[model samples]
Target chain A: MKFEIIDYKDTRSGFGEGLLELGAENPKVVALIADLTGSLKMDAFAKKYPDRFFQVGIAEANMMGMAAGLTIGGYIPFTGTFANFSTARVYDQIRQSIAYSRKNVKICASHAGITLGEDGATHQTLEDIGLMKLLPRMTVINPCDFNQTKQATKAIAKHKGPVYLRFGRPKVPNFCPPDCEFTIGKAIQMTEGKDVTIFATGHLVYPALEAARILEKEGIQAEVINIHTIKPLDADAVINSVKKTSCVVTAEEHSIYGGLGDSIAQLLSRELPTPIEYIAVNDVFGQSGKPDKLMKHYGLDAPHIAEAAKKAIQRKA
Target chain B: MPEISELQAIASQVRRDIIRMVHGAQSGHPGGSLGCADLMTALYFEIMDHDAKTFDPDAINRDLFILSNGHISPALYSSLARNEYFPVSELATFRKIHSRLQGHPATKEKLPGIRIATGSLGQGLSVSIGIAQAKKLNKDEKIVFCLMGDGELEEGQVWEAAMYAGANNVDNLVALVDYNKKQIDGSIDDVLPLGDLRKKFEAFGWSVTEMNGNDMHEVVSHLKQVKSQTHKGQAQIILMHTEMGMGVDFMMGTHHWHGVPPNDEQAEAALAQLEETLGDY
Candidate 1:
């Protein structure tokens, strides 16, 4: 399989672009920020649609509750904040007002995982996927690249219910096709192979693709599938891909617990038993460093995924 | 509008319902419920222009009320029922398994009058501000009223929401505090004193109004005045004063009944003090 690299861009740009488009297309789309407009790339949307944009001024708890209230008046409110503050600091507010109440709130979080860099462990959130997916009626999406994130931003607006849209701050290789359409709860098959399956999400998808290329040179055809939507896991896609491969390796820039890997392992353990390897953080806090160095140190780069894929293949029955 | 005497008769029945409901559940907050009975009665029966039969969660053009301190759900449930939001007999199922009335006010069961879930304190004010802003965005011109316990003011998020509403000029909102001066452990002064609430709210850019919440006529007239003050470039908050347990004799003036329900003989004695004008459910 061949693909073209479009450019190097942060996935948050995709969110900003998609939000800007929504501002023009849908009159009811409102944007709320807790003082991180420039970082989240919500500046353009806030400027273009000033009336619909609300700056809550560093109060995340109030922002979450206000977002829940905005839905009561039939408005689609997208709240922007850092991943840590978005989930951990305001968990009760989200639980009572947004998730349990079943408010049509889109909780768009930026600077997810250690890729946020330099900000250290306090700013990075590796437990966000687990925290969000645990709540009933919550749809969690962690898009891979600029193109996919943009499409996902537009997709969640059309799909009603509570959604946690996770993205990052670093500029990675934006290889996904610009025209690719995003569908909620559907997995995107990047490359198909027959020996082993490499399931990846968020910033780790490009590395998984690279890992597949490395495995191909060693006479191993590793399949790479993008599991963007974590909750409502695409069971058919996982089962079908694993049936041919018979072994699995899940990769993500999140903690090993309650991330994409756990979701897949739980699925396969119940449906079709298979040996699995998780390429994620081993339940530890991240440190301040360069994003690429952090990825390498945490064993989240391409070479690590390739090695994990081989280990998974070796363990298959 | 109902006459003052008529509203008082409804309040008397609402007080009786509060006692009966708490006694039946044996596990609800009755002190605050009994204290806010008159205010709740005034809001549902006369103050709010709400359609109880055709209750819409959106509440579009109607006045919306949120019980922020949801532990006192007995009062809200009785008021909603007395206003015909649901069958009055349903109040018997409070805090039971497979019942719509959870320990707290929740929207999950699709209860007609509840727009959002509350029990976790300090969240309702923010939600009410959000609704008020939405009404402004939609040009609906409807008022949003939120009732909070004085003890509920200790949560930091309340002030966060207070600052936001004041800064954003969320003028269509009317926030009221059940200033019973008592909390579960002890009085609010002993726990965490909210020094000079009127000055605090005034400092936060709210036009403050003080009223006796237990009096039916005062509650009705003050709420009406607050309603007329909406869309006037500042949010309004009424610091309503009342006893911890206002209606009942033995229960008044203490925080012990804040969550304790009356027993069999105690319920009979409490019922004897209050006249059941509208007939008990």
Candidate 2:
């Protein structure tokens, strides 16, 4: 693996910009905001497509219902809110009106993970991916960086059915290729190696990349894969990578239980079982801190990932 | 419009199906289904511009109905089957293994008439509002009908949907609350009293109306009158007064039968009292 330093931006901004572009491209693309247009970067979409944008006040439950209603008449509704409000706040509404009904609704959530600093534990949501993925028809995506997030937003709008597109707020290094293909249920292999497979998603991808580079210097060649789509998981791709590596290190800015780490563990346990280590938020609430400080405190930084990868590789060896 | 006698006949048949289906499964909510028989019969048999043969689940032009109180799926399944959405014999598969007739309504099994899944309370209105909004966007002049259990109103999202419909003037939608005044736990009063439901809906800025949900004539006429009420700067809510288990004498006037199915002997007695009008499914 080669060390590549690159400029980065928050994936939430990519989602917001992509939403604005989607509104301009399609007349039927309607957006509903639950008092977080600015945070979600949906202000541009709202401003450009005023007629198509609906401000559902601060009522997230109503916004969810209205979005579902908008789907009946054949409008592809995109709902914008913070990750906390979008998942736990109106989970029942999403469960019945959207997922159960199988409405073609897009739930675009920003400020995911502890990257949303200062707002503290109440605002930071680490279990949204697990919540959305459990629904039968929901398509959950946690894109790693700006380019992938932007591409995922556009791609989800084109695909029918319910989608939960989660992105973080903090600016992270964009290592993915600018013209990379965004396919749901397909993992992107960033660096291929034989000692360990480091599967990562969302903001954690940058740390996994950094950890892979650090591990390379120590003679432990790590294979890094970006698992963007949590549901409709690419089992074949995961199994193939694990077969060669024999060990797995799962990383995400989410709870170790029921998050991306849990999904990977379940997959590996079923097919080509392997020893796996998790680099994620332990079972504890995050406190107010700077983004970098929170990442380190929560054991989600690069060194933590590297250590976890080393441990997993050692277990396999 | 379907003749009053024909709708009545359909309602009676729906009642038969509800009893037989619930009896066979030995599980399901029969009270709400029997209560909404007339309303569903009128909508499927007459009002809704739907087709039985070409049952395109997502056909945009036709009117859509969402059973928010999905425990009442026996009525919905019977209505779909009798209307020829699928073979009437498929009614035997209700709640059976691998059956599309899930205990609750679902689209996962590719059920012909079900566009969205509903069993959880207070969600149908929101879904109906979504379809209604879509209809407005596409210039589709069809109405979206959503039926909710009176007890389901306890869910806060129902009120949220009510507020959105009222605030947005979601006129192309009609939601009916089966005011049977009962829930799974007990009478709505015992569980959670929703005082002055009609007043609450009125306060929410909806064009409120009331009707005997069990009466064939009133159900048809009220729905007809309320049809054009949408787009008039207010949503419509018909507070349908119904007796839980209206047709079966044994189950009426008590919350005992809200979710529990009858034993074979009890089912026979219940079915014998309610005339087998259009023939059992």
Q: List chain A TM-scores, every candidate, in order.
A: 0.99, 0.97
Please identify model 1 stretches exceeding 4 Å from their true place.
none
Give TM-scores for every candidate, taking all chains together and pairing residue i with residue i.
Answer: 0.99, 0.94
Chain A accuracy of model 2 expressed as TM-score: 0.97
Q: Residues B112-197, candidate 2, lDDT per residue (tens digit)?
A: 99887788787778778777877877778888898999999998888888888888898988899999899889999999999998
- Chain B alone vs. reference chain B, TM-score for every model: 0.98, 0.97
Writing each residue's lDDT as its tens digit, candidate 1 over B1-281 gives 68999999988898899899889988898899999989998988888888999988888888889899999898899899988899999999989888889989998579989889999999999999889888988999888989999999999999999999998889999999999999989988999999999999989998998999988878888888888888899999999998887889899978999999999999999999999898789
Off by over 4 Å in 2: A1-6
Lowest lDDT sum, 10 consecutive residues, model 1 chain A, at A1-10
Per-residue lDDT tens digits of candidate 1, residues A110-154?
999999999999999999999999999999999999999999999
